[model samples]
Target: MTPVSSPYVPDVSRYTKRESRAVPVGPIQIGGGAPIVIQSMLTSDTMDTGACVREALDLVEAGCELVRITAPTVKDAANLRAIRDELRSRGCPVPLVADIHFKPEAAMEAARWVDKIRINPGNYADRKKFVVRSYTDEEYASAVARLEDAFLPLVHLCQERGIAMRIGTNHGSLSDRILNRYGDTPLGMVESALEYARICRKAGFHRIVFSMKASNPRIMISAYRRLIAVLQELGPDWNYPIHLGVTEAGDGEDGRVKSAVGIGALLADGIGDTIRVSLTEDSVREIPVAEALRALVEEFAGAPRPKEALVPPFDPFSFQRRHSHRWVRNAKVGGGEPVRVAVLEENFAALESASAGTEMVPELGYRPGMAEEVDPEDPATLAELETGAPRLVTVRDGCPYPPLYAFRMLAARIPSRHPILLKDTFFPGEKGDPLRERLNSALQVGALLCDGIGDAVLLRREADPKKALELSYNILQATGNRSFKADFVACPSCGRTLFNLQETTARIRAATGHLKGVKIAVMGCIVNGPGEMADADFGYVGGAPGKVNLYVGKKAVRFNIPQEQAVDSLIALIAEEGKWIDPPRS
Candidate 1:
């Protein structure tokens, strides 16, 4: 399918508009806004000329605008030329890209066969011929520097021979300094690739494409967003073609979902010129998945996104910007305190009862029906919330007919200013029921589009009030906010279990129950549990059923506390740790 140019977008000056020297890959322009091109790689070894040709044909049929084949070794490079020849013989005119690793020789070899070449900075070293994982920052920097130098000759060749060069960064192969400073973050990946792009520009090479590859959807989206932001800031000179993909995305549902989220988010933002939905399964069938993602993104963008859904002004750096608003503490919150939210009924009595003697309205500045209202049940009403606004809604949690259809109607009538909030009981547990399933579907649909919704989220069982409290804390933490009191990370006991992970965790939670922004993890075994709980500020795990190992940031501070006193002992340790924060009042 040909890409339809968007009418409202002003001409982006970031890229050079010269079409004379540019390579036209089917209907898409590589060096221009020439409607985004979709590209995929051939997993088949190039030496298997027939396999390569067959894969290329399949990809082309699946709507792949361009196909890249791996050219890792010199022999593979020759196979690439044969496959390219076979493609032409079979009447498949899809543009071919050569996936090149660090070797300049390999790049130069494939430069003769493929339409485009992707050079990753993660491979090759200055003095050494090659090295895969250079763990040190200096080594990584040197590799990238060397990669830039090696790439110039290839870029020069591309310019001479009329092939495009894509500077790509793989998340798994990131340099030591980048990993140390950024820790598998998209910012680090974008910055690393940009550093190479800068080198290419300095060398006077303009035929460029950039990609930051990761299997994780979040990382992929984050990297692309950062790259676009940087490109926008750099002005027209930095605009180059961008290839989208979830690198090594596993097969089946996982691959599809990862590719959709990563590619979809970028496409909606008007980023990404080409895409590849890298999958582990048959490379032949990968084409349809990529096309599906493209179609889905286009369809989503085709739908009119409400302007009111844009995030409100705030710090631009946060992931919070995607939703278009930042929560700023108001005088009502006082001294920049965290916003306190209550999930209650929406009727006059409930609102009156819940809002009475509380700062929810005052902190947020509300007039009854002043901020636009939507049916708490509507899915569409949940999209595009302003930044930092805590959602408020009412749900008939206990009612049999929770008003699904009515909510849908109310959703369409909702004004953009307000987000939806529903009561907790509306959402059923993981166990399925029709009413519960419908609510979950609505909630997911709303959340997926960046719409905000709230529920006094339910727990598995209410018999143990402690379980409900713990569950609530977990829910708030998942949202990236931790204003809730005490999060307990406990594991389910298995045959390998040594201690009472459930009861012991409960006791610790009870002791620190009043403390907000604190997390305690309880695990079944001492061996892997402590290591897994490294992120927690404090943790305890069963060494044996009666003994426990205590930790603070992965450091084994205390060992083998008896089971009977384990909870109390951990509580005392927490009291000591509490000094790090201002002391809590009685």
Candidate 2:
């Protein structure tokens, strides 16, 4: 859960119980003051009437309030009727939604049978040649006008049929105008959807859901967050249901984790109305994943949970595989009894008690991990701050070996700013001056002060005969200090400190500015250097002149270096440790 500072908690709390205007579908009410709805789409061909019905029923059993079917062509659009009829015949009353691309006929066909229709404004505009393909102002306006006219009729048809509409904007199919304005950000997707949503509102149809989907989880999460923020400010009175999804969310576990993190983030903040866990694999896989993610919210809100009992009949067609029927039934049942899962406060106690099985009780309240009493004397205060700043620290490596270069390459590989910290400034007393005591004190104080103000700090260390830099970095990370800097551990070399240790260390530190929240170490003297540098995200040690040991965590990667050019070699190594720059002190 994203910890809310006291001040922002109210901002979030405002929406917690605020009722939204309901958007009605056969038996379900979306948007206006409804339960957080779980939804998914069928990957089976829509034209395969039997397959579509089977998938839809599966999703319904999984607890899906609605299921969207892709109607790419007029032929596919006809499946909506067959699918809806099949569901109704089977005693499943779930609403069917048609997802159409560009063809207006497809939309019309689905609108006749499906309860809802989702259309891409960009795609609709793409078919009608109005805009000059070449960038020209006069041609663009003319195209925009034609595009608006093209969608106005579809909006009118939806209004006439009393069909709900979702203006889904994909990252791939952005409007040229919006793309030019906002670039290809999730924001652009939001703006594009908003333009269509505005058209719908003007057409006197308030039944709407907006979706902005991206293949990238980070981009998807940020776009949704921003969209909610904008809607909160722009249409406080209007609570149109928002559809959540991670488009093209890969396949299997990789897809599941990404979608979970992205959707989970928004749902945790109480932003989503309906969620779809998009996966490249069969849409059937999407059902269970969506239900699980929504279950988190249920668990958090202390709402009724799905029955933990294994499927009684273990039927392959059981709804448990599609949606959490148990949870929804519990919600409908409304006895307000809690559901329980296995959670032991003390594993040792559970192990010790031979007769004890899993505790079966209702979820009463939030159980935070690692609860501890706050100590006033601790420099960092848990009291939430008003700043909406994130509380993440970067992890970087400051080793001066081949691994450092590996770190650098990784940093360069990332599209965004390397989040690890950079460590360049040497702490006082590295040379073992009598000032070592004062330096350690200064460093610790610096850490505490930075942490109190919500900063990520990096602990830079040296490669010595005894410890690895990663060990030091981990020790600091365990502090959960917002003021954490990447750990930079450098060696204290003497005239006998073999392998241009000083020069390599300094250059490695200089190279770390790009990365953030990293712990790196540069050490000399093979005999004790490797062991001395512990807890470093990356480590580079002086290993007999032309060779150096590079480490990620405690694992070493072998690298050969020429003794005469060891400093440059070390620089190359540290660079590979990715970005390990210290976060800016608060």
The C-alpha TM-scores of every prediction are 0.54, 0.52
lDDT of 2 by residue, 264-326 (tens): 645644667788876544455567777666655643354322212111111111111111112
User: What local lDDT score does residue 511 receive in model 1, on the 0 to 100 scale?
Assistant: 70
Q: Distance from true position, residue 29, model 2, in Å?
A: 1.4
Model 1 lDDT tens row, 70-153: 676777876778888888988877887777664678788889877778877555322322123536767666666766676577
Whole-model lDDT values for every prediction: 0.53, 0.51
List candidate 2 stretches off by more than 4 Å: 1-19, 127-140, 302-586
Which one is best on lDDT? Answer: 1
Lowest-lDDT window of 10 residues in candidate 1? 8-17
After superposing candidate 1 on the true structure, give the runs of residues whose Cα lies further than 4 Å from its correct spot: 1-28, 124-147, 180-183, 305-309, 312-586
